[model samples]
Target: MRFNDVIMALLVIVIILMIIIPVPLGWLDFFLALNISLALTILVLSMFVKETLEFSVFPSILLITTLFRLALNISTTRYILSDGKAGEVIDAFGNFVVGGNAIVGFIIFLIIVLIQFLVITKGSERVSEVAARFTLDAMPGKQMAIDADLNSGLITENDAKERRKKIQREADFYGAMDGASKFVKGDAIAGIIITVINILAGFMLGAFTMGYTLSQSIQKFTLLTVGDGLVSQIPALMISVATGIIVTRAASESNLGTDVLSQLFAQSKVLYIVGGVLMLIGIATPLPNLPFITIGIAIMLSALRLTQDKKELEEQAEFESEQEEERDNNDIRKPENIIPLLQVDPIELEFGYGIIPLADPNQGGDLFDRLVMIRRQIALEMGIVVPMIRLRDNIQLDSSEYLIKIKGNDIARGTIVFDHYLAMSPGVVEGEIEGIDTIEPAFGLPAKWIRSEDREKAELLGYTVVDPSSVISTHLTEVIKKHSHELINREDVKQLIENIKESNSALVEELMPNLMSLGDIQKVLSNLLKEFVSVRDLVTILETLADYARSTRDVNILTEYVRQRLSRQLSRTYFPFGKAKVVTLEQSLENMLMEAIEQNENGTFLSIDPMTSQNIVASLAQEVRKLIQMGEQAIVVTAPIVRFYFKRMTEQSIPELVVLSYNEIESDIDIQSAGMVSI
Candidate 1:
């Protein structure tokens, strides 16, 4: 129905018709040019494509172009035999390309055909077959590796599915290429046969049918035959070369041309040796002086240039390092330079030099990408925007050690074994695989630094295996979550409001500057975050604040109302099993906390004697331990009134324990009291 739908079909039909019907000289010349240009483009693409899958459709294109070349060959053959003229393209190749010398041109044509058929086509066929066989044979091992990564949580289920699909596509590509090589081989042989037939048939037809002499027949037919062979076989040679390149390409980040150039001239010392050897031969042996000496001089200059470039890069790195140290020293002389010291990165990951390659993208490290995903992960899970993390190398640290800093102070630190996998048992171990014992940084679980080769075995044995980068990333994510509340500021809060204002402008317009100031709202959100609660549901948080600010201006009181409003979300977050296992406070203790609660213009506080507060905390800790012993998180549920007071009293003693008001639990959730607390 549309032009694009049947454009390829129409081209195929035209090619077939060209083989049967006589082509005019003008159209034939155009087809000849098209053939050469298409072959050249294919050759260039083969060299530039970085991956085999990137050129997956190459086999199909090869077959179609091969058929098109054959159609042109047939059309040219008909014209050369019947009319004694093919086209201007063929005539020019006959006269200009080989100086009108039919013998030399014919020999060149034979060489090109033999080279394509015997060398490029045959080698490409063998390579394609080998690649296909190897891909199929290695399929099971690759599949197992994918499964191991997925089982170990190194990759997601979607990633495993994509890798499996890629493996299948690669196998199919190699198999198709293996068969396509035969077409090129066949095309080469056909070119030789057609050239011989053209020359023989043309010579006889000119001599007998036209009453021409030997010289006239020889001159007319020989030149045409040589030119036709040259034009057809040159393109065939290029296509065959392209096929060879495609089949032999290995996995690389760069194209074939860049890879070749980078690797070929990587070492200046090797070039120096080569240049010296060339000069020695020119001076000491019986060889021509001019060409050899000139080439040697050029090579030595190139080596010198390479050496200079390398030195400049080294100097640049050293100068930057020196400048950093010098700046620190210079800052001590000027007390006015305190501004630089006052500014701190929101988050910084400082690692040792041994881990540089893992952070350097030039060396194929994906640490940057992993950091980006970490931000996205937190955003999706906590509904908060994380600040950009800065990564730097600290030479003073141990080679394997790294530190996580928040606002210029170290919060957590860990070490990683580069080029090794960290494998930890998930409460199950079938067999013991030898490795260096250590602890996983994220959860402080007992783990091992195992060789990469043993990762599959570790995963199969019910161990969770993760690479060095994944280990660090997981650790960073946990630290961010633990201190997520501290990372947000007034600016971040304002941005959150601006985001909500896009769709529900009235809610934002009614909430901000009307009931609560920006500082009050920020403090409320921070308090919620300090309790490991998500401030992502900004609309509900804002609505609750708007409803309750008339009654109280205290952020702590406002936060409690917001938490009560987010009961459903909280219920799902902590009690996914539709039941809550928590430690409940005694009514007598709750009454004591309600009586001890004190308020000021600043905020609310729990005003109690130190000895009584310690006794209450000790009782609460005793009850929390009961829940923790049963593999449940430490949760304290109190009456809505004393919830804030109880949490304020016992926070220092049980920072990890969650304090929830009875009103914070959803109505549908069943409350399973794990233990009771009293003082």
Candidate 2:
């Protein structure tokens, strides 16, 4: 049998023997039977109504009620038998232990209950410890934001540091709150209730008079009536119950419900005056039982209601939070037309201090001191400072040859090309990447064919770490070059480049394998701008790449609309070309177009309709004047007789100027896109 079943069976057997053996053996048998019957009824009732035995204030109701009646019967019977002319009683063991044995058994029961109390209280402590750890871990990101803003000249640095310190203080505060929570947890409150009830019953029995006296009892029984002592105990009783209720309500997270419960159930100084009045009633009146029962029951019921209220409130709040999350998910917008950008790759860091004997994963203080010099060197290079060190767990070191085999077979053999640079971009910070040429021979290790562990070793050797993004552009460039053959036109390639230049990598991560679609690209950008705080350099890169990509494809009409809507952005500002150049490229192209338009008509021009010729000439002249003023590098016009192009003269020793179209006016067909512009 399980331990609980064994204990329970022993208790049942004890009660049964006490009731049965005394029945045929003595005059006090009825009283002994009453106590046994009460215990047996409780045990049996607990099987069906398991909650009555639960370690909560409600469970104390059943225990205290049953024990109170047991005390009353035992006291009454013992006094009658001992004071009267009855022979001594014999127990089931045939020992003449007298009428006092029943009281002895009750004392043993109290001891067993205390042991159970400790077990439940310890369990509460453990649960609260886990809760405190979770709250501490989740607060870091918020702390970092405040710190960054303060450091970037937007806010005072001291304020940011103070904010971080406040978060730590809050974590500690919650841990203390957990301790307070233990006082009101089920087991502690239940134990307190049982103790208070026993005190009340003891006071009444000792002070009240029912004309009862023990017959040949081991100790004399008092006929004391309920008196001033009941009054004195009332204050202490109120204090204990009020403490339990208030602490329980405060520790719970249900905001409004907890507040209401706390206000209603928690006692005020006014309640203490009322309690004092009840004490005086006990001092003057013989019938003190009603007041005790009323007060005790009131406190117990209040505790139960507060517990239930907290639970219900939490359930409602949890449901609301879940619904809010669902709505957020549904409202997520997918962009109809956008672009894709660069790809990101994860980089690993290798620590040089191979399996050190004294490393403590949870407490990195000693390790930080040991590695502080190197860390500071890297930090100086990177231009960053970290007040605390965070050490990762589960680092492994292997034999040199094993490292060589893994690096050679698994890493270098893979599809990634790495370049190594010592101390690359300065000191290492979290999320930084350093390039490595080959995975082999860093620490008796080589870049080629390195295993994962060996690659980690190389990181420890000379490599610095960088953000996953710092290398994304390089990776995308490689991908484009490899897949350029698949592109249908130069515009496609240009669009791809633009998208890469403008996209935010962290947002692109959401699109995953479907990043090729415009909708996915737009969704990523929207999600990124909405979700992330303090946009990093990576976010800037993604946005740039996206804009560039859209320009190349010209698929999203929104870009064109934006281009036209923002006149300043589209206005060409470059004027007379340069020092090494005779004229500005824009002026040269404009001059060329102008010369071509006039020259194409020949030195003398005529038209069958003189008015049509004048209109054509005038329109051409206005277009030329605007082209020069606007500073455009190129412009095309469709006309009746011929097409003209002003080609900028570059090869001839002639000044950088425009040339007329001696070439034919080709078929008037629409060319959809500008190929590529190299800057």
State which candidate has the highest TM-score.
1
True-vs-predicted CA distance for residue 528, candidate 2, Å: 21
Cand. 2 TM to true fold: 0.24
Candidate 1 pairs with clashing backbones: none
lDDT per prediction?
0.88, 0.35
TM-scores, each model vs. reference: 0.74, 0.24
Best by lDDT: 1
After the best TM-score superposition of candidate 2, give how far the Cα of residue 222 lies from its true spot, in angstroms. Answer: 15
Ten residues in a row with the worst lDDT in model 1?
147-156
Per-residue lDDT tens digits for candidate 2, residues 556-655, read 2222222223222112211122111111123333343344443222221221244533443444345444555654433332222222111211212222
Residue 446 shift from truth in candidate 2, angstroms = 21
